[model samples]
Target: MAIATFGLTNIHRRVDITEGGVLGMVLLLDHHFGIPPWALTTVLDAACYLLGWKVLGRDFLIRSGVATLCGAIFFRLWDATGPLLPNLSAQPLLAALLGGAFVGVGVGMVVRQGGSSGGDDALALVIAQKTGWRLSRAYLFTDLTVLGLSLTYIAPLRIVWSLVTVTVSSLLIDFVKTVGHSENRQKA
Candidate 1:
């Protein structure tokens, strides 16, 4: 999730596009209200963690905390090594696809392990638990809400691309989760 966050931000910077999760809200806040992404994300994620603790129990909190910490560390590490990485943004479409895939797989793996990487993932879990909806549907609902809010700040064309990224990521996350579940069932 952290590596994918880096890739998403890289694409956003290169192509003037935005993301569609909590990260997108962070970026929008930064753009429109002069808030810093790191600060906002920390506060928001902390609130989400607290909520998860209350609703999902202690195990979820602990695992999520670990995943969140790892994500933060990896994001910073990737930022520091940014110059060493090749520029993937040269092709915006490919960058978006790859970024979406990375995010999907990363988030999927974390969730499959009973952890969450951010507020978005926690929210999706909560929604799924409460409503009996699929995790992907929950993600789609929340992500689309954020993306819609983002239209106030982002260009229409960029928003279109962001939608594509979110859609692909959402589907892939479901795919990964389904496959993991099937494998675990097989093992059992």
Candidate 2:
């Protein structure tokens, strides 16, 4: 959560790059409605958690709760602070790549533990279970939906850059999970 927060504060916001899934929607709503991202994140995350609990079961809820709380708290803590790292607005590609790495590694760690750092995971899992879609397909569907909506506020070129970040993050997330799972299996 801290890494993801740092990426957003130091790079994404500076580069004017938007993300997908629930975070993207939070950014969109915050931009148009003057709602704080933390508030939006909490409400939206809680809503997804509720739905996920109903669909996925209590174990899922328990697993996600901690990371969800940490995410909200971390976002709140990181909320008002200025970027601690150098601004990467002038180098958008680098910003995008770094943003992807931060999110990928951070989220992958949570996911490997059978937890979620964001509502996107629960939502995607719910969608996958209910609709019989693969988890990857569900995630892609949600990401594309949010990215498409973001087009209203974000530029086409910027969205393309966002695609790059998403692609990198997705691949890295899978890589991390796969590698971690393999290592665990080998250890066992």
Candidate 3:
């Protein structure tokens, strides 16, 4: 389940991957060196899962598992459909808005279930555990940092688009916690 979460979720939804970057760096290295990056990432992800299970317990394990599965499946579908989409850069703002909003909602659902989708998600949990910081705030800060760093590679306007997406994502995650979870509980 945790494996699935890694495939989904984003910062705009208040779930960041800063710490995941640490692991990502390892994955990147594997890519750069011609090693199977996914292999390494999978191992790292598994280790993280174990850590979560040991420290964070069953709920987190379940949450992480479902989120990871959903993320992987959703992203694979999104990517498969990517070829059908038009050029977003023609109207960067609109692209960002739509992309971020969609990603945000998807991510929000993962978070609301109490499973981190991936990367900085584990870090956010670590921060929460070590310093008692609110996971939401930690996630936002980590994601913003990531988005800012992304600007170095992508254009400034594109960065803005990413931010819009992140905002929508965050809002969605919050909504999940506020409304979705409650409704789910009532249904149960």
Q: Which of the numbered candidates is closest to the native, going by highest lDDT? A: 2
List the lowest-lDDT window of 10 residues for candidate 2. Answer: 179-188
Angstrom error at residue 160, model 2: 1.4
Deviation in Å, model 1, residue 127 alpha carbon? 0.8
Backbone clash tally (model 3): 22
Candidates arranged by TM-score, highest first: 1, 2, 3
Residue range 1-188, candidate 3, lDDT tens digits:
32222223322222222222334345345545766767777876787677767777789888887777766676576555443445544565565565555644555566666777765566556555666555555556655776665554455664565566556555555555547343433211
Evaluated with TM-score, which candidate comes out highest? 1
The regions of model 3 sitting more than 4 angstroms off are 1-40, 43-51, 78-87, 125-135, 180-188
TM-score of each: 0.83, 0.78, 0.61
lDDT (Cα) of model 1:
0.75
lDDT against the true structure, per candidate, is 0.75, 0.77, 0.54
**Model 2, residue 124: C-alpha shift (Å):** 1.9
Clashes of 1: 0
Question: By the lDDT metric, which is better: model 2 or model 3?
Answer: 2
